[model samples]
Target: MKHKHAEPLYIKINSIDNVAIVVNNEGLPAGTVFSDGLTLIEHVPQGHKVALHDILQGQPIIRYGEVIGYAMIDIKQGSWINEAVTKMPTAPQLHELPIATNVPEPLEPLDGYTFEGYRNADGSVGTRNLLGITMSVNCVSGVVEHVAKLIERDLLPKYQNVDGVVALTHLYGCGVAIDAPAAIVPIRSIHNLAKNPNFGGEIMVISLGCEKFQPERLLKGTADTIPIKLESVDDIVTLQDEHGFKAMVDHIMRVAERHLIRLNGRQRETVPASELVVGMQCGGSDAFSGVTSNPSVGFASDLLVRCGATVMFSEVTEVRDGIHLLTPRAANQDVGQALIREMQWYDDYLAAGKVDRSANTTPGNKKGGLNNIVEKAMGSIAKSGRSAIVEVLSPGQRPTKRGLIFAATPASDFVCGAQQVVSGITVQVFTTGRGTPYGLAMVPVIKMSSRNIVAEQWFDLIDISAGDIAIGQATIDDIGWRLFKLILAVASGKKPWSDHWGLHNPLAIFNPAPVT
Candidate 1:
């Protein structure tokens, strides 16, 4: 079913593009004529591309002025070009990627911007003063979860200044091959999750004493750098050590109160916006993602970089097709090569799993007019803006430098969000077109809608709308500045819609290691 627009409008990203997407609410019907006098011979869904010219079999279909795909058959000038008709193009060869060849001149510094934040003893800033109780083994997740609930209900009311408590539980700890070569990733990720800035330096781990991943191994070298165990591992709570569940709950409650007292004593102080570590990601994205929300995020990302804040953009498969565009924007050869290495590692990892980047796009993505990952990659990288990628990190690794960074992680929404939290994002800006209730318990997730319809329909869920850029209502710069202010406000203790409703999915740690 197709709907006709009174004024048939289509969005063409670039002059060189051979296709333009329909902009009508339900998409334009067949025989619809645009102001440019181009008649659509077939119905094209909103955000779905229309072939601007007759395409021959094997001819490239150009969108974003890049070869997103090739025609599977001879196509009409005005037909809807979809996944059924298009063949995805080959990804760029990693070996031949340009390194720092197109770095832009630095943006003018954005100074004097500040946020109210909780300052930690490790020189980190917390957007929330939370007591994050974690565990080395999933065997104790149930008890830790039980303890976190009790802490929230019984203890949190007494500590009014504390934001909340989180049970940082995951399925990675016990069963898998903990001694595998790649096991270090999820291991280090678990260790660093205890040190996230939002935790306010009161880190505690609940361990199942018999588990292979012991308490000592989890806390081995983190004491000096992070504000963790300077004394001994005696502070770690062990489930097996307790006599009963009641005893376990009571012991955890006692320890939680101590941490909550310390956390409650903490107050927000005015800190420069440069202390902000913002992670940008997109999920349930569509073609409008690149056209609107992602570009707006990219704009804000540049502003954050100018203000000396650390920003990260991830999802390796989402950026794989656009790696050529990103390599040249790297700060130097080392950063560029690091990006390639991560890409290559993921490529190998996927190969081992008998899949490829094509598996990254979801059914919702294709339904929302994303034909393939190649096109989605073009849209996904827009969140990084034009800032030079200063650093590249493996999944769950923390950042050592500021500015823009490429944190290589899987494109799964939950996995990316969890890894970003481990990488130290105080706030996250997530954009979507298919609309999701994807929130993070570890950090505040600001949801931005990629289309006006989603914004209107999910009004209570969406904090901001970049959909205006799709219409003539606003420019990317306009939304960018607005998003920047929103980031500052959210970081300064204002709750985004996700946090307001307390809607968050459990943290999904990226464990590429074996499950034996």
Candidate 2:
């Protein structure tokens, strides 16, 4: 895909920016010259920055109109600026951040948009019709997974209306300090997972009987609970009380049949787009992530909000350096402080681990042209769009208010995905530059690529390509509208490539509590 002899191109994000990224497919050679007459002193790789002007040592390297790093030595004009010579800037002091100083005026409400979905007994709606089997602890995961397979093979075909069966299995329940204050993070996550809208209304619980987390605690969640709108008591299968492994399997299958019969009666109806709960996240990111995919996602996020849908953007460490920018956009002072509260809590947690936010960046990120965590954080916040932050949630907590929300969780892709599932995202919108095959069985994931090269190479795996914004082929709004329509299509029963191929990653529950 390299530009053989086409016009040299580069992208400078802001008028004040002194560095611009190479836009050619592979890169430009040493003698390559832009139409503006800037000649590359050395070979500059695609997505890597080229100094627009000579930068003296200690001068700030700016991008997205913020200081991403500082030059370690004199950088000649047209030279490639990368990790080896850039020093990361200090994070903005949390205590000194301004609160609610730049709240955006609300966008006009977008009305009349709808999607075909199954409405649950609880006011929630589901994009998929399926039976979910939840376990009280990791001890029952093996049995539950086995039972789920048997149900799919033997019982699923009989229930014509049901889409599929999912084993909501995770590694939590008995080993650690369950009563510790921090344990609530994982405990609440497991509790809320059973209530995910895609699971329909019936919850089948399988318990090891003697695990620290009992079925009762899972069903009767904490005070911040959304009442479980069930027609009757949730069925609980105790593995310890069964006579043998086969007996355990038989008992679960019997319980699952009852749910399948009930779930089979459900049907899809046209529901307003407002019922959609969408989560946005980035994984295996790159330099173009901000300029292309993330901005497009941000645009769609705003559209979802204007249409009265609930949208959430997460990953704490990825947004830490950019918190100063977000706090000012909070709906009010209280919301702004809530954003800081979660940031402060994570700061302390990181200190205890003897690491800081700098640990968040990856080697893949550097290869993709990101120099440090500061640069990554600046890019990560682009998915938030320009909407006012309506609310903020603690780790593993669901939202009380709608619009745009910030759900705090670690930057690990799997962990963040799991927490968002527990927080009640019916459909997840994942963006990537370096690319990932990440998908979730419970929810439909619409994979978006930040660069056309990735979208073309991983064509079958990617659902949408936002890379055109990097060149001049498309505007962010155009791709954003395109993604918005694709989301509605996926919500209305269209399968993403990942789902078509049955590609999915295992759930990684966040348990910050002690193992002992």
Candidate 3:
């Protein structure tokens, strides 16, 4: 397995898909003959299709060997099927899928792997180290950002070891119901920032003191840094508030001075692959994500898993429709039961909210030809690869089991990335079909554009353009190996393409279950 290489490839999603995904992008025309060593299907344009044989109106259209949709009206033995013109037949009645009962074999561990990471005081390892500044609410977000930016530009350049200064921000903190919250963005954001491997000490939390995020709770949750401190300013004096900001800024400078020794000494050390947790996420997906970037990431993730590393896969609603296909081999009965329970819990929880998990796709996904959550999820879930399900955890909970850890987070890309950070992902592999520039604070997002056009258009945001897959230039397996080594370089302290281009730094927390 490798992340970097060049070769043509195709993936058989299901035995029925007459068209396999084109890993190599060129030379094949709509009428060109295609073969998978089993069946000879005709070639169509990327994201389009070719017929396996003469078809009837009721016959299903297969790709990846599974039913993506059905032919509306068809008769040709060798004709191209355009996704735009395709329509699915009436839904086939579904029965309950049988649950697997037996414990599966322990998967083969990944081999010959090592990464440079920091050993935190908590015994957990981090991929990067930084002195972070946290905002208590959106009201003072600008102040926090100003203070952190000053440190990043002025102070960080002086410190050889510290990664840099990051100020984590969000859209909520006041004027909203803290309980029964519409979104627990602030808390989740802070929690995620604190958990990200990049931070090495207690962050300076700036607040006006009356916000929803009480200072005590925030401090209590974050007490690992050497010296924890807080500054609560009085809101009564408008003139005095300006003075307070200056005084607080001075205090942070002093606080920053205090942590300089520890921050400066932080260095990367050789760590086992087991200590690594990679976030698997996809956004701006198109027809190519499932076939190229998604599966390439999956194969890369499998390599990491075999080397004893953990990969966190999110976007439950998209993939919930295929739990049978997505569930990895579990370590034991306990692990397997946990995996099943997690899926069932999502079904019940969303139902309680009067929201069906199946309706989770965004407008962008629909515009790109995905009609429902099932199709989107089946494609997105491909990033996790085949591995054992070691544990299932809620957002912010650290993964104790190795291999694949299923983090229960919303399907939205940013929200899932935030939760993955809280679950201890040191770095992330983000696959996009259309294009997205989003990145999480503290965690380095490695963006891979699935199509050549999107990659060329958004080269600044996409770190790895998988356009080669669509152009018939590289096999997903070859790209998988390329990605694997690039990730190791990332773990070794190479800045992700996102960080190099200054693309992300937002935080979010999940507050599932009502706060009574």
Candidate 4:
């Protein structure tokens, strides 16, 4: 059938690319003619690949000027190249990777850029002044949630400056081997979540008093090498310490009132953009993610790095196939090695589960024209921009250095967002090609749409539209600058769509350790 774009249209990422993604919304039928004299021999779905030339079986299928995969069958020019005819390529070997090589010349620092932020005692900056309630284990989630609602109704009205109360509840802390070597991931994650800059340094914990992750253990100093003293007893309110439900809620509310008062005392101050810790992630991604939204985010990331801000790009499986492309941009050999170490650890983790990176590709990805993980990864890494990888953070570890950081976490969107939050990101920018209502309670999440259709359909959910870049309505730089400005506005307490609607996903801690 003839599509809306009667004239065939496609997007070729690189000059050397042998395939291009069909840009028509409905896609063109077989025998469609193109301006470049290329004719489709078969129907090509929207966002699906169309081969530019004939390829022999087992030959590399090139996209983004790299081998996304190998053809499993001989493919003729102008034919659809789906996952069924392509085999994922072997991952790049870690040894002999280029270290501190080809680091791009530093962009001129953008000065005089500032945002209204809450400066923490520890020198970190917070985009939001919030009171975060920590749970010792999942058993206390209900209690914490009840207390949080009470704080909103009974306590928040008096604490005008406090944005809101967030109950940092997760599925760990009980029924798990908290002493396992892998347990550090979840424990550290929970620990750092309490210290996220947005929480304003007023920590409160609700415990069941019987879970493996005791309040003291979860708050045992700071997870980072920084020696912040712990005060778990004063900050914790255990259910077992109370006589009745009313008494329990009253005690928790009393502690929460103290935190809300402290948090309310905090006020937004003029701070340089350098104090911002921004996380970049994508979820429900589609083909346009790489072409439009991600590239714009990459540009903004580079801008943030230029301003001496810390920008973290994560999702191990999403970037696994592109590891070779990343190592060469490391700021030093140590950073390069750290990147390799995390990748190897994840490789082993996946192997232990009897799965591989291929499991990362969801049906939404395939429907969006991504055939395999290899193809998806190339798009995913674009969010990092071209900044040198200055440092690497293990799962749940907070970032100590500035500039671009690679915080390794599972490719699951919720899990990745949680890790980033715990890693101390004050704000998050999430791009989606297939729209999601994902947000976080602790920090503001800026949602960007990769396609015009989704942007138009979800105008209330999406904060910005990079889809204009795909449809020739705007340039990547245009969207990038717009996004950068929006980030400042959001950081300055302008509520984003997610926060306006109070839509937040539950915290999904990365618990690699065993249950019980």
Looking at model 3, how many pairs of residues clash?
35
- List where candidate 2 sits over 4 angstroms from the true fold: 1-5, 226-234
Q: Give each prediction's root-mean-square deviation over alpha carbons.
A: 1.8, 1.3, 5.6, 1.7
Per-residue lDDT of 280-377 in model 4, one digit per residue for the tens?
99999888899999999999999999999999999999988999999989988899999999999999999999999999999999999999999999
Whole-model Cα lDDT of every candidate shown, in order: 0.90, 0.91, 0.66, 0.90
TM, every model:
0.98, 0.98, 0.81, 0.97
Ranking by TM-score: 2, 1, 4, 3
Candidate 2's residue-wise lDDT over 1-516, tens digit each? 543437888999988888998888888889888999899999988889999999999999988889999999999999999999999898889999999999999999999889999999778999999899988899999999999999999999999999899999899889889889898888888889998899887988899999888888877766677545444453888988999999999889988999999899999999999999999999999999999999999999999999999999999999999999999999999999999999999999999999999999999998888999998988899999999999998987888777999999898989999999999998999999998999999899999999998998998999999988987989999999999999999998999998999987888989989988
Off by over 4 Å in 4: 1-3, 221-232
Distance from true location, Cα of 249 in model 2, Å: 0.8
Q: How close is candidate 2 to the true structure, as a TM-score?
A: 0.98
Residue clash pairs of candidate 2 = none
Q: Candidate 1 local accuracy as lDDT?
A: 0.90
Ranking by lDDT: 2, 1, 4, 3
Q: How many residue pairs clash in each candidate?
A: 0, 0, 35, 0
Model 1 bad stretches (over 4 Å): 1-5, 221-234
